[model samples]
Target: MLIDAHCHLDFPDFDADREAVIERARAAGVAQFIVPGTTRRRWPAVLSLGARDDVSVCLGLHPYFMEEHAEGDIEALAQALEANPQSVAVGECGIDARFGDTLDAQWRLFDAQLRIAKARKLPVVVHCVRANDPVAKRLRQLDLPAGGLVHAFAGSPEQAGKFLDLGFVVGLGGAVTFDRAKRLQRAVQSLPDDGYVLETDSPDMPLAGHQGERNEPARVAEVCRVVAGLRGQGSEAVAANSTATARRLFRL
Candidate 1:
C-alpha cells in the first residue's frame, strides 16, 4: 500500500468531495495520508480528520500565514499534542523566504515548532522554499529527535544529501513530473530510494498534464510512476520502499 506522506484534506479545497477523494485514494492503493494543520485555527479540523482510520495529522502554524498566528498558539499546540498522543508529527512548518519581509517571524515560528517536535520525539513535515541553507543550518542546530520529510522538495542534490544525512526523507511529488523541472527530476534520480517518500500535496502541485487543475491523493500513483521512471525502478518498488520509509519516519 502507498502512503501520501503529506496532504491537506482539511482544507476547504476538499470540502465538497472529501469522502470521495479518500475513497478514490483507497481504491488506487493509497492506504494512508498525513493531513497537516496550517495554523492554530485549523487544528480542530485537522484533528477531526485524523480521527478517521486511514488518515494521520500534524499540527503547527504555517509560515505563509504567519501574520494570523498568535504567540500562544505554540503552547496551545503543545496542549493539543498532550491531549492527543496519536498526532503523527509537528508541522507544515518551516521557512518560506518567498514572501520576502516576514523572514524573522517565520524563523521564530519555525524554531518554536521544531522545539516542540524535538521534545515530543515526533517527526516534522517541513515546507521550505528559497531558504534551504538557513533551514538546513537551523535543523543542524536543533538536531531534531525524529527526523522528518522535506515536503515538495525542489532543492539541489547536495542540499538533499544534507537533509538525508540529518535523517530526514525527501518528499517527491508532482513537480518532478514537469518537463521544465530538470534539476528536481535529476535530484529525484540521484537520491537513494530508501530515504525518500511520495506525496501529491494535493489541491496543489498538480502534475504536468494536469496543470492548472486541482490535485488529489488518488493522483499519487502518477507521482510514483514518475519517480520510478526517473530512478530506473518499478512503480511498485517505489511504492513499497517509500511506504516503508514513511511508516518508519512518522512511526505510523
Candidate 2:
C-alpha cells in the first residue's frame, strides 16, 4: 500500500469529486492519505475527512495564512486535539521567509505548535520555505517528537541531515520532478529510505509535465516514479519504503 504522507484534501480543489479522486489514488495503490490542516478554520474539515477509515489528519496553522490566524488559535488547536484523540499529528505549520513581515508571526506559531506536539507526544507535519536554517534551529531548541515529516522538503543534504538527526522524515514530491530543481533532486536521492517519505501536496506543486494542472493524490505514484529514478530504485521500492516510513511516523 502507498501513502501520500502530506496533502490538503479538505481544500476546495477537491470539492467537485473528492471521493472519486481518492478512488483513483486507491486504484493507483495510494491506499492512504494524511491530510494536514492549514488553519484553525479548516480543522473541522480536515478531521471530518480523517473520520473515514482511509484518511488520517494533522491539525495546526499554516504560515502562509498568518493574517487569518488569531492569537488564541494555538490554544484552540490544543483543545481540539484533546477533544479528538484521532489526530495523528500536529501541523501543516512552519515558517515561510518568502513572505516578508509574517516571518516573526510564523516563528511564534510554529514554536507554539511544536510545543503542543511535544506535549501531546505526536509527530508534526511541517511546511517550510526559505527558512530551513531557522526551522532547523528551532527544531534543535525544542527537540521535537520522535517522528514527523518535513512536508515538501527543498533543502540541502546538510539541512536534511539536521532534520533526520531529530528523527524527522524528509518529504519528497513533485518539486523533484523539475529538471531545474537539481538541489531538490539531490536531496531526494541522498535521503535514506528510512528517513524519507513521499507526498503530493495536492492542488499545488504539480509535477513537471503537469505544471499548470491541478495535482491530486493519484499523482503520488508519478512522484514515486520520478524519485525512484533519481534514487536509482524501482517505483515499487520507493512506494514500499515511503509507505513504511510514513506508517511508522504517523502510527497509521
Candidate 3:
C-alpha cells in the first residue's frame, strides 16, 4: 500500500468530490492519505477529513499565509493537537523564505509548533522552502524524540543530508515528475532505503505536464513510479518501502 505522507485534501479544491477523489486514490494503489492543515482555522476540516479510516492529519501554521495567523494561533494549534490525539503529526509548519513578509514571525510560529511537537513526542510534517539551514537548526535545537519529515524537499545533496542526519526523511512530491528537475531526481535516486518518503501535496505542486491543474493523492502512484525508475527498481518495491517509511514516521 502507498501512503501520501503529505497532502491537503481538506482544502476547498476537493470540497465537491472529496469522497470520489479518495476512492480514486485507493483505486490507484494509494491506501493512505496524510492531510495536513495549512492554518489553525483549517484544522477542523483537516480533522474532519482525517476521521475516515484511510486518512491521517497533521496540524500547524504554514508560513505562506502569515497574515492569517494571529498571536494565539500557536496556542490554538496546540489545543487542536490535544483535542485530536489521533492526528499523526504536528506540521504543515516551517520556514518559507521565498514567500511571505515576516521572517521573524515565521520563525516564531514554527518554533512554537516545534516546541509543542517536541514536548508531546509527536512527529512533524515540516514545510520548508528556501530555508533549510534555519529549519535544520531549529530541529536540531528541539531534538524531537519522534523526529519529522521535510516535505517537498528541493535541495542539494548536502542539504538533504543535513535533514537526514537530524532523523528526518525527505518527501518526494509532484516536483520530481519534471524532466528539468534533475537535481531533485538525483537526490531521490541517491537516498538510502529509509531516507525518503512519497507525497502528493495535492491541489498544489502539480506534477510535470500537470501544470495549471489540480493534483490529487491518486497521482502519488506516478510519483512512486518515477522514484522507482530513478532507483532502478519496480514501482511496488518503492511503494512498499516508502509506505513503510511513512507508517513508521507518522505511526500510522
Best by lDDT: 1
TM-score, every prediction: 0.98, 0.98, 0.97
Give the Cα-based TM-score of candidate 3 against the true structure. 0.97
lDDT of 1 by residue, 1-252 (tens): 899989999999999999999999999999999889998999999999988988999888899998889969989989999998889999899999889789898888899899999999998989999887788888989999799989999988889999998989999999999999988888888898787999999889899999899999999998999999999999999999999998898888
Tens-place lDDT per residue, model 2, 175-205, is 8989999988878878888989989999898
Residue pairs with backbone atoms closer than 3 Å in model 2 (clashes): none
**Weakest lDDT window of 10 consecutive positions for candidate 3:** 98-107
lDDT of the candidates, in the order given:
0.91, 0.89, 0.89
Error of 3 at 121 (Å): 0.5
Better of 2 and 3 by TM-score: 2
Note the clash tally of each candidate: 0, 0, 0
**Model 1, residue 227: C-alpha shift (Å):** 0.3
* lDDT string, candidate 3, 1-252, tens digits: 899998899889999998899899999999888988898888889988888898898888898889889988877888888888998888888898986568888888888888999888999888899888888988898899999999999987788999999999999998888899888878887798899999999989999888999999999999999899999999999999998899899987
**Candidate 3, residue 9: how far the Cα is off, in Å:** 0.8
Q: How many backbone clashes does candidate 2 have?
A: 0
